[model samples]
Target: MIKLGILFGGRSGEHEVSLVSATAMIHAADKTRYRIVPIGITKKGDWLLYDGPVEKIADGSWEAYALDCLQKDPARYSIAILGTGGRSLKDTADFIIPAVHGPYCEDGKLQGLLDMADIPYAGSGVTGSATAMDKIIAKAIFKDAGLPVGPYVPVMAEEFRRDYPAVKARIEAQLTYPVFVKPANMGSSVGISKVNDGSTLEAALEEAARHDRRIIVEQGIDGIEVETSVLGNYGDLQVSCVGQISYTADFYDYEAKYQNEDGLTLTIPADLPEEITAEMSRIAKEAFLALDCCGYARADFFLEKGTNKLYLNELNTLPGCTGVSMFPLLWKHSGLDFTQLVERIVELGYERYSITHRG
Candidate 1:
C-alpha cells in the first residue's frame, strides 16, 4: 500500500480551516489503497504525527482528539518519504498530500522544504505557488495574457512608509471610489478591505501593510462571485462545475467563510446560463495554462449580475478542500467523490515528480 503523509495546519490565518479540509480528505481517501499518516503543524510551526483520526483536524479539535499521542518536541517536521517508500516518515512516503493553504504553507515555502527533502508532493511548484499567492503579480500576469482584470496599482511598503501623501495621491489618481485594498501575498480574504471613498484609503493601506509588505489597491469589483476549478498540467486542462458565492456579511470575509456559517450562500452548479458557465470555464482553463499551473487551482471571477461581464478575480494555488469547501463540492458534483479527488492529487504529485526527476 502507498503511504501518504497528509500534511495540514501551519502558521497561516487559515490554519483552522486546513484542519477542516484535511479531515474531509482523511474520511474520503480510500484506506484500502493507501496508508494514511496524519501530520499536523501547530500554531507555533511544530509538526506532530498523529495516529488517531483526521476528523480532529477537521473540527479543529486536534489536541483534544490526540491529547494522549501529542509529542513533547516537534523535531520531526522534516520527512524522508519517497526514495524508499511510505513505511516510515523517517524513511519513505510514496507521495505527500499537502492539504495546506494560505501564506506560510501554500505560498511555495512548504513546497521548497519538500523539494529539499526530496519528496513528491501534490499541488503547484515553488514558482507557481509563489506567483499565485501575490495578487499584484498574479494580476499582472493575467493582464499580460490578455485576461480581463480591473484597473489597479500595487503599492510597496517602502513607498507607503517613505512618503504617505505621494503614495496615497498616486492611488487616488488611478482608481476611483469603492476600491479594494488587499495584502499582495495573503489569502482567505485576510487583510482585505473595501474602501468606498478617499477618506478610507489611508487607514485601509495601513491595515493591509500589517499583513504583507506589498499591497494591491484595485477598483472594487461590482458583481456576484463565480468560481471554477482547473485541473491537470498547463497544456491539458479541464474545468469543474461553476459555483456562486452570495455573501450576507458584506464581503467574503473571514467570518463569512468559517465563523458565521450562514453568513453566505454557496450555490452549486451555479444557476448561470449554459453559455456563461462555458465562458467562465474557458477563461479559467486559459488562465491556468497561461501561468503553467499544475495539478489543480481554483480560478474565481466576478460577474456583473445582469450583464454577465466577467472579471477574473484571482487563482487560489491551494483552494479550500473541506467538505463544505468549493473544490471538493465541485468535483463531487462532477461525479468524483472526495476520496477520489485527493487520490488524483497524490497521483499528480508523483507524475509531476517523475517529469522533474527525468531531467
Candidate 2:
C-alpha cells in the first residue's frame, strides 16, 4: 500500500480550520489502498507523528496525545521533516496531501520543502501557491491577463505607520467608504474588516497590518458571490459546476464561513443564466492557467447585482476541504464524491511529479 501522508494543523490563523479539513479528509480517504500517516504541526511549528483515533483530530485532542507519545517515545513519534534517512518526511510517505491551509502551509513554504526533498504532494507548486496566496500579486496577475478584477489599492504597513493620515487620504481618494481592508496574504477571512467610513479605516488597516506587512483595500462589491472548482493539470483541466454563497453577515466573514452556520447557505449549481455560468468557467480556467496552477484550485467571482458584470475575485490554490467547503461541494455537485475527489487529487500529484521529473 502507498504510504499517504496527511499533513494537518499549521502555524497559521487558519490552524483550527485545517484540523477540521484534515479530519474530514482522513475519514474520507480509502484505508485499504493507502497506509494513512497522519502528521500534525502545532501552532508553535512542532511536527508530530500522530497515530491516535481520527475522531480526536477535529476537536484538537489529538495534539495532546501526540505530544505525550513524542515525550515518551521521541524516536517513534517525532518527525524530522528535513532530516535524512528513515525519520525524515520524504522517507515516511510516497505521497503527501497537505490538508492544512493559509500562510506557512499553503503559501509555498511547505511545498518548497517537499520539492527539495523530492516528494510528490498534492496542490500547486511554489510560484502558483505563492502568487495565489497574496491578493495584491494575484490581482496584478489577473489584470495583466485581461481578467476583470475588483478595484483595489495596495498598502505597505511601514508606509501606513510612517504617516497614517497620508495613507488614509490615498485610500480615500481611490476608493469610497465601505472598502474592505485585508492582509494581502491571509485566508479564512482572518484579519479582514469592512470599513464603512473614515472613522473605522485606521483600526481596520492596523488590524490587517498585524497579520501581514502588506495590506489591500478593495472597493466593496454589492454583488452575489459565486465560486467554481478547477482540477487536473494544465491542458487537461476539469472545471466543476458553479456554487453560490448567501450569508446574513455584513460580508462572508470568518464567523459566517465556519462558525454561526445558521447565517450562511450554499447553493451548488448556482442559479444563474447558462451564459453566465459558461463565462465564469471560462474565466476560472484562464486564471488557473495564468498562475500555472496544477492539481486543483477554487476560483471565486463576484457578479454585480444589477449590471451582471462579473469580476474575478481570487483563486484559492489550497481551498478548504472540510465538510462544508465549496471546493469539494462543487466537485460533488459535478458528480465526484468526497473519496473520488481526494483520490483524483493524489493521482494528479503523482502525474505532475512523474512528467516533471522525466529525464
Candidate whose lDDT is highest: 2
- 122-237 per-residue lDDT for model 1 (tens digits): 88888889888889988999999999888999998878889988988998898888898999988878888989887878888998898888999988777898898977875777
Tens digits of lDDT, candidate 2, 31-92: 98999999999999988899999999999999999999989998887667876877889888
Pairs of residues at least 3 apart in sequence or in different chains that clash in candidate 1: 19-57, 20-58, 28-339, 81-92, 81-93, 85-92, 86-92
* Poorest 10 consecutive residues by lDDT, candidate 1: 73-82
lDDT of each: 0.81, 0.93
Evaluated at residue 270, the lDDT of candidate 1 is: 95
TM-score of each: 0.92, 0.98
- By TM-score, the best candidate is 2
Q: Which stretches of candidate 2 lie over 4 Å from their true place?
A: none
Prediction RMSDs, each to the true structure: 2.7, 0.9
